[model samples]
Target: MRISTFLLVLILLTSCSEKDKHPYTFYYWKTKLALDQEEKKALDKATAPYLYTRFFDINKVNGRFQPVAVITENKSFDTDKQIVPTVFITNQTFLNISKEEIQFLAENIHHLIEKKIKEYHLNAGQEIQIDCDWTAGTRDDYFSFLKQLKKISHKGVSCTLRLHQVKDKALMGIPPVEKVYLMCYSTSSPLENSDKNSILDVNILKSYLSKLEDYPIKKIEVALPIYSWGIVTNHLGKHKLINALSQNDLKNPNFKKVSDHEIEILKDGFYFGNYLNKGFMIKVEEITNDQLRDVITFLDKKIPEFTIIYYQLDAKFVINQNFKLISKFQGDF
Candidate 1:
């Protein structure tokens, strides 16, 4: 009875100060999964101890023409933040979203945002952030797209730009981007005995980042991969193609389920011959201590103000890190 009474009092105190005032945290969902009640509880329990220490949530909105919010994640929303939440639309194919499309999506998104806020009985936060990875070649078009997004979105709408691999001297002047996310990972696999010149390209990226010294560091974020991926190719499909695949050269997924004919085709050297002796093997890459240190060391010196965003909540490839000391990230061995 005493415990229950104390809990009620605690809840009342917490209810009085739910809205938080601080920089928001933006997290991208690598894959769409329907969140469940148990899972939601698990998450709340996991982050409960942190409380206002990390007070923000980034609900990623992904898809093409469908304009779908397919990720229906369940959360306690009992966060220290009073803001409803923020959204980051992740896509870059369209040269322009067009005023018409922005106008259309805004209508639907507003209601969704409102419903979540009401369901949680909390004040929804201001602004929507779109995530686009475009290049200088399409500078004009990208700006045009941002204009459309800003115009149609609620009053304080903004966007995030994915800076995976950029030239040191790509842009002359700072354009309009709420935050520029430097993505330091490859869609492919990591190479062995590499100095990580390909991913973060430390020396090159640092030189280019120097030019952006005038830009707002608060708006800069770095995409550090907590995940790893090896290469997986369909030998059967590649057989009819021009370029053959080298198995040993790339990390291959387990293929016990692969067809025998595919293996035979691979053996013939038409596809996946880069690896020796039916050597089609996959090399799984993770956030090794050396790789993490390499990235942290570079970013600490190059772009210190940028927030380090964990790519997703969890990916088969991502490392679930909680301790800050794990600057040298550790994952499945």
Candidate 2:
């Protein structure tokens, strides 16, 4: 009886220790590597030890695969904070791409990463992450490109996994990487005229994460959304994503409250560089603190060991977030 009781206590202690060890990091996903005073304060408040910075994106332009929106590092990061160079490749880049082209692309990507690291004096060279929403048709080529990149870069490689890829791994196949960052947001397209929040819907998240534990990749990190956007729609059913506009921006006299999550443009001319007509509707989609806590609780039950990476590092969002609530389930950041 005593032995059984001791074993039970040991199990409880082990579980608690594991729960306390949930390390978290941030993803800096901006085209320009510069942080304002507020952003710097947010970083310090979060106590993030490392940042996954986007180096550039690869897209197909005029039938040629090329890097676009390459990051310009205007400011250097703290020496103590590590930076993980990240590259986002569009899935269309792999459509009908040849093996030779894949190899060439991998080589050029590696070279550019090295060049940027050197040029910007960035304290990064350890790990590289690739973000791509690859389909079954392009899976093989994408995996091949990752393999080539891994071989050439000689650094740990990681990739982003969407919800569909997690649930349908058998069909989509997994990428050749050491770790996969499961993106827990962006469940749907913003262009859709649905009432649901495309940034994050708990119902949609639950549907896709049913078999999360059974995912083949053991080392899985989760990225949660901390950003919000305004979906502007006109009478003709046309939609545009005004990323800079948030719920707070709706308080202006130019907008009239339509609903708790929606507003109508009143006598609008130009707002946030977008010309809007009167009567245009805007849907504000954002994740709340309570919703974030619920997601953390749910994920803690599913993933025994994983890191939480906030989708991005933005001052407006990060400064307003309650990190105490965010770190409640997973311990302090």
Predicted structure with the largest lDDT when compared to the true one: 2
Provide C-alpha RMSD values for all models, in order: 11.6, 3.3
Collision count for each candidate, in order = 15, 0
List residue ranges in candidate 2 displaced over 4 A.
1-19, 76-79, 330-333
Name the 10 consecutive residues with the lowest summed lDDT in model 1.
47-56
- Tens digits of lDDT, candidate 1, 1-333: 999999999998865433111112324352232334442333343321221111122222353444334334335234443331345443353445565655555565555555654555554445554555546554555566555556555445455444432442346223465655566655322333333423334454455555444455356655565543333334332212212222332333333223311222134243243443353433333454466556656555554444454443332322234424433232231
lDDT string for model 2 (1-333, tens) is 999999999999987676555567678989988887767776665544778899999999888988999988776555456788999999999999998999999999999999999998888857999999999999999999999999999999899999999889999998888799989899899999798889999889988998898887888887888888889899899998877557788887888898988988899699778899999999988888777777777777777677778877888778767664475565321
lDDT of each: 0.43, 0.84
